[model samples]
Target chain A: QKEVEQDPGPLSVPEGAIVSLNCTYSNSAFQYFMWYRQYSRKGPELLMYTYSSGNKEDGRFTAQVDKSSKYISLFIRDSQPSDSATYLCAMSRGDSNYQLIWGAGTKLIIKP
Target chain B: DTAVSQTPKYLVTQMGNDKSIKCEQNLGHDTMYWYKQDSKKFLKIMFSYNNKELIINETVPNRFSPKSPDKAHLNLHINSLELGDSAVYFCASSWGQGGADTQYFGPGTRLTVL
Candidate 1:
């Protein structure tokens, strides 16, 4: 099994609808979880980051981490067409020099 | 001003040829990294440097080498590239060490080895 798993979904949703993206990992030592958004033909841009478990919210976006279940989620509320992008989940063990283990990104499309 | 810049936004070369992708960051970051995104969109870390010193070199083949002559530059040189080497290469930089540091990525260079 891959260390980090995410569905490569061309998930479609209406504008203003709430969208949820998730990732599951096999490594219990992964303490830092991150969400990155990548537009077409561009590099991944860091969106949300969290340490350990719990939820962190910024504007209409929220990131949740469930360490017990080895799951992490990124919720986008009132999505817009401009929000359409590939979302990548990454995790690291938080060692001194951390190298990220990234998931196969989920492609999301917010229809107008 | 662009924080991170990469030359040859698109690279096309024949198999068995040599190529190099240059990366530079004006962010004054201490840590730099190279990541490869395959056609399947699977990203893997290929190499990392700290202040021009090699820190992490992943399981990539020896044909791939990362050179950092200064803290602001990290370049990847591929010798006798193969078909499998065709992928998007990204250069990233972070302010410090550890997982907590936020990495800033450059616009990737898409390499096609035919």
Candidate 2:
């Protein structure tokens, strides 16, 4: 089984709508969680980052991680067409290796 | 300016052929990584280098080799490429291999093998 699992969503939402993207992991050793946005034919861009089991907010985006549940989420407020992109959740355990395990990206489309 | 860059943004080759994708990062980062995004959009780490030294090498096949000429460059070479090698390869770099500090990714190279 993949360490991280995420729905490969083609979720479409109208502009200004709130969007929630999530991922689940089997490894409780994961301590750092991150959300990345990737546009068509482009590399993944870092969107939100959180450490362990708490919520971190930056502007209209919020990242929440529940270590006990091994679940993480990325929330986008006032979503725009420009925000349309694949959202990928990634995690890693610190101190030993720096390699991050990734999930299959969820494709998101924002309607204008 | 492109902080991290990869050559041959689109690579098309046939099976049994040998090819290499070159990557360079201008962010002055000590650590660099190579990741593969399969058709299912599953991104997996292939290799990583820190300051011209080999660090993290995943469970990749021996046919897939990564070379780092310096701290700023990490290149991937595939010998006897197979059809399963068709995927987008991305190069990324981080300021340090620590903390929640994010790694910056380069525009990926899409490889299509016949």
Candidate 3:
């Protein structure tokens, strides 16, 4: 099984809707969790970052990590068309190397 | 100003040819990374350098090479490119090698190997 698993969803939702994107990993050693947003033809950009099992909120985005279940989620409130992009979840063991294991991104579309 | 930048934004090369992608960061970061995003949009780290020293090297083929001449520059050179080499390459930089360090990414280089 892959270390990280995420549904590659082209999930479509109306503007102002709440969107949830999630990822699950098999490794319990992952301590640093991150969410990245990638626009078409562009590189992935860091959106949200959280350490260990907790929730971090920034603007309309919230990142939640549950170490017990090896799950992570990014919640978007009042989603906008500008939010339409691919959401990727990444995690690392916080080791000296700091190598990240990535999830296959889920494509999200916010309709007007 | 762009924190990270890559040259040759788009490359279309024939199979068996050799090409290179250059990455530079003005962020004065100590760590730099090279990642490959396949057609399925799965990102995989190929190599990483910290302070111009190789730190992380994945199981990539020898045909792929990464060079770090300085802390701000990491270049990837691909020899004998195959059709499977067609993918978007990204360069990222961080202040440190710690896992909690936030990575800043550059505009990707789209390589089309035909």
How much DockQ does model 2 earn? 0.62
Task: Report the lDDT tens digits of candidate 1 across residue range A1-112.
Answer: 9999999998999999999999999999998999999998998899999999999999999999999999999999999999999999998987877788899999999999
Assess candidate 1 and give its lDDT: 0.93
Better by lDDT, candidate 3 or 1? 3
What's the DockQ for every one of the candidates?
A: 0.76, 0.62, 0.79
Among all candidates shown, the one with the greatest DockQ? 3
lDDT over C-alpha atoms for residue B102 of model 2: 87
Model 1 misplaced regions, further than 4 Å? none
Per-model lDDT: 0.93, 0.90, 0.94
Interface RMSD for candidates 1 onward, in order? 1.2, 1.9, 1.1
- Candidate 2 residue-wise lDDT, A33-91, digit = tens: 99999999999989888888999999999999988888999999999999999999988
Regions more than 4 Å wrong, model 2: none
Looking at model 2, the pairs that clash are none
TM-score of each: 0.97, 0.95, 0.98
Task: Give the clash count for each candidate.
Answer: 0, 0, 0
lDDT of 3 by residue, A46-72 (tens): 999899988999999999999998899
**DockQ for model 3?**
0.79
Order candidates by TM-score, high to low: 3, 1, 2
True contacts kept of each: 0.70, 0.54, 0.77
